[model samples]
Target: MTADRARGALAVLQDADGKFLCEVPCGYIVEPTASAYHIRRERARAQRRRRAMLRRRVALTVALLTVAALLAALMPWSGSGAADKPKDTTAGTLEEVHQPTAVLLPSSGTVAGYVPNAAEVEALAKLIYGEAGIVPSTTEQAAVVWCVLNRVDDPRFPDTVLEVIEAPYQFSGYDPEYPVKEEFAILAADVLTRYRAERDGEENVGRVLPAEYCFFTGDGRRNHFTTEWKSTDCFGWTLESQYTD
Candidate 1:
C-alpha cells in the first residue's frame, strides 16, 4: 500500500472525517459529533424539565388532596333527616336540672301538626315568659308551652297558637306588647322544634307533659299542671271535661 493507505490502516480509532470512533460494549462503533452532542444536551435538558414538571404536578395534587381532607374533617356531619332538625341550645339549662325524658304520643285532634314560624315562636315566647315566672325552671317553661300547644290540639279551642292565646280569658299572660325574654325565646324554640319533629313522627323528642294533661294554673312562684281542676284553684274558672282532649 502507499503512505496514505498505511496511515489510514494505522488510524483505526478515527473515522474518514477524523472524528474519534468509540467501541461500545455491544460491539458498535460510535462517532460523537458537536451537532449530535448539542442534540443530546437539548434532549437531556428537555427530560429534566419534564421530570421537574411531573414533580410539580405531583406536589400540587398532594396539596389539593390535603386541603380537601382538612375541609372534610372540619365539616359537621349529621344523619339523614337530622340536618334540617332544629338544634337545641339549652345545654346550660338542662345541666341545671335533670331533664325529663320526653313522652312521645301520636298527635291527635284538629291541630296535631305544626311548622314553627317566627310569629308563632315570638307569641309563645312572650306567653311563656309572662306565665313561667321571673326565674322559672326549664320544666315550667316547657310546661307552659305544652299547655298552649295542648289547647291548640283540642278541638274545643282554636286550632292555631295565636287564636288559642287570644281566646279571651284562656291565656292571662298573653300580651302582644310584651317584650319577649331571650331564655323564654330559646325555650319556646326548643319545645316547638320537638313538637314539629314529633308531629313528623320523629322519635326521642322531649316533652314535659302528655297530650291529656292540658290545664295549668301558676301562682307566681310555680305552676301546677293537672288533668282536672283542683278545689283550691288559683283561677276560679271551672272547665268541663269537654274542654280537655
Candidate 2:
C-alpha cells in the first residue's frame, strides 16, 4: 500500500473498487470490512433520526402544557373577583352582575309589594319607639319593627300594619297621638323599603326576626322576642298555639 502524503496523518486507505479497507490514525491501524462501514453509517443515520423525533416530542409536550395553563388561568374557580360574580337571573336574563344584599328604594312612592303611606310608617315607627326606643340598640328597634311586619305577613294576625299595631292590647306601646322619634321614623321607612324591594325580588333582604317569632314582651330593660307564649303577663302571644289549644 502506498501512503498518500498529501492527506493528513489520520487517513483512510481504500482498495481499487473504492471500498474502505482500513484507517491509520497516528500510526494506529484499524482494519474494518466494507459491510461493517456501511452498517456503521446506517447506524449513525438512525441515531440522527431518533434525536430529531425526540426533539419534536419534547416541543409538542411543552406546547400542550402552555395551552393547559392558559385555560386554567381563565377559569372562575381560581378567584372570587369578577369571574366569580353570580349571574343575574331576574326576568330570564343571564347577564352577570353585582348582587347586593339590600338595594336602596327607588324615588317613586309606590313599590312592588305595598305603597308607604304616612300613617302606616308613623304608626309602625311609634310602636317601635315605644317598645324598643328606651333601649340603645338599633337592632332591638329593628327587631320590634320586624315583629310587627311579621304579624302583618302572618295569616293569623291583621294584614295591614296599622291594624296589627292596633289589634286590641297586642302592642301596648302604640298610641295614635304619641310623639315618634325621627330615627325610628327613618328606620321604619328603610325597613318598609327593603320589604318592598324583597317582594319584587330586587334584593335579598333577610328578616331580622323569623316569621315564626310573633310574640315579644319587655321589662323596660330589654325586649324578649319569642316564637311561643311565655306567660299570661306577656304583651304578645302566638295566635297559632292559642287556636290549637
Candidate 3:
C-alpha cells in the first residue's frame, strides 16, 4: 500500500475500536504439544498480544527517530547558500591577507624587440617558408613585414621583429615538414637591402608610389597599388588600410 494509506490504516488501529483483541486462537499453535489445550491456547493468545505491542512500539520508535534525524540534517548546520560560497570579502577590503598579491610580467618583453636586421629578416623569411612550405606571395610578404614592424613597435612582443617571429614554442623551427625555402632567403636579402636604400633616400626618394602602411590585398588582387596615392589633392597617402584580409 502507499505510505499515506498505510499511515491511515495505522491511525485506525490506534482508535479505541482497535484495542487489543485480548484473545487469539491457541489450539492451532499447540497441536503437536502434549499439554492442557485450553491453557496453552490462552498463553499463545497472550504471547501474540505481547508481540503485536512490541511491533507497534518499534515502528513508532523508528518513525520518531527518523523524524528527529531529518530535522537535524536540515537545521542551519551552516548558514545560507551564499554563505557556503567562500565570501570574497577581501575583494573590497584593503586587508593584505585577502589579496592574491601576486604580480605577472609578459614572458616576451615590455616592448616587442628590435627591427629585423638584413640577415635576421632573411633567416626569418626563409624559415617561415621552409616551415609552411608554401610559395611566398607579395601579400604574404606584406603581412610579415607589417607584423614585424608592429611587433617591434609594440612592447607586448619580443624586442625585435625577428625575435618576435622566432618566439619560443609557438613555431617549431627544426621540423622536417617545415623546410625554409631558398627563394624566401633571397627575397629577404633583397627586401632588406631595398628598405635600407629607401630609408637612406638613395633611389625614388621623393616619389610616393606606395604608402608605407600598405600591407595586404583587399580587391582579390595582390600587390596592386591604388591610383589614389598619386592624387595631388591627397598630400599624403594613408597606408593604414593596406592590411585588409
Candidate 4:
C-alpha cells in the first residue's frame, strides 16, 4: 500500500481449509520470537502456581475443622475441663452429666440410705473406683457405691463416704496419689445424683436399688463380719461387716 512496498514484501499464510494461519514479515506470527515465547511461558507457570496454592489452602481448612470436631467430642458434658475437679461443682443442685448410656449392672437390689453430703458425691465416685477395679461392670461398681452409702446410713459405720472409704485396710488398693478417671467420676455423679434425689423424695426411674441393704466383698470369707440373711440380696452374695460384734 506504500511506495516502500518494494523494500519489504507482506505475506499471509493460510491452512488447507482457507483459515488464516498467520501474517509473515510482521514483528510476531504463529511461531513467535524467543522473547515473546518466554513471556507467555512465564505467565502460564504463574497461573499453575496460583491453582496449586488454592488447593493447599482448601486442604488445610478441612484439617482444621476435623480437629475442632474431635476436640468438641472429647470435652466434658457439663463443658468443664478435667483440670477442673467435679468437687468444684458445689453450686446448688448438681447438674446431671450425660454419658452415652447408663452404667449397666448385673443386678438390681435393695440399696438405700441418706445420700452423702451434696458435696461428697465426687469423692464417693473416686472411692467406689478405688474399691472396685477399673474393669468391674457398671452393676458391680454400683454395688460398691451402694455399700459405701449403706455405711453412711448405718449408725455402726462412719458418717461420711470419705471416712468410710478412708477407713484403714477397707479398700485395700486405695491410693490418693493415683489419678481418678473421668468415666468413673461420671458414673459416680450418676449414682450420687440418684441417691440424693431419692433421699430428698424425688422419684428417680434410674434408681439402682429397691431398698438399703448392706455388705459386700469379693468372697464371703471376711473373718470379722456377719451375714444378715442366709441367702444373697441381689448383688450376687454379700456379707455385712460387724466390727463391734
lDDT of each: 0.57, 0.59, 0.38, 0.48
What TM-score does candidate 1 get on C-alpha atoms?
0.47
Scanning candidate 4 in windows of ten residues, the lowest lDDT window is: 76-85
- Per-candidate TM-scores read 0.47, 0.47, 0.29, 0.40
For model 1, the stretches where C-alpha displacement exceeds 4 angstroms are: 1-115, 231-245
lDDT of 4 by residue, 1-245 (tens): 11111225544555434455555563333342345546777999999999999999999999999987786565312101233222312222222332222333212322454333433555555554445544225655565566667667878668877887666535543445433445556556556656666676766435443345544433321211123322343343343321112
True lDDT of residue 36, candidate 2: 62
Report the error of model 4 at residue 102, Å.
20
lDDT by residue for model 1 over 98-137, one digit each (tens)? 3332222223321334545667777877676556635335
Task: Tell me the alpha-carbon RMSD of every candidate.
Answer: 19.6, 22.5, 25.0, 17.5
Best by lDDT: 2
- State residue 37's C-alpha deviation in candidate 4, in Å: 99
* lDDT sort, best first: 2, 1, 4, 3
lDDT winner between candidates 3 and 4 = 4
Can you give the lDDT of residue 2 in candidate 3?
8
Backbone clashes in each candidate structure, one number apiece?
0, 0, 14, 4
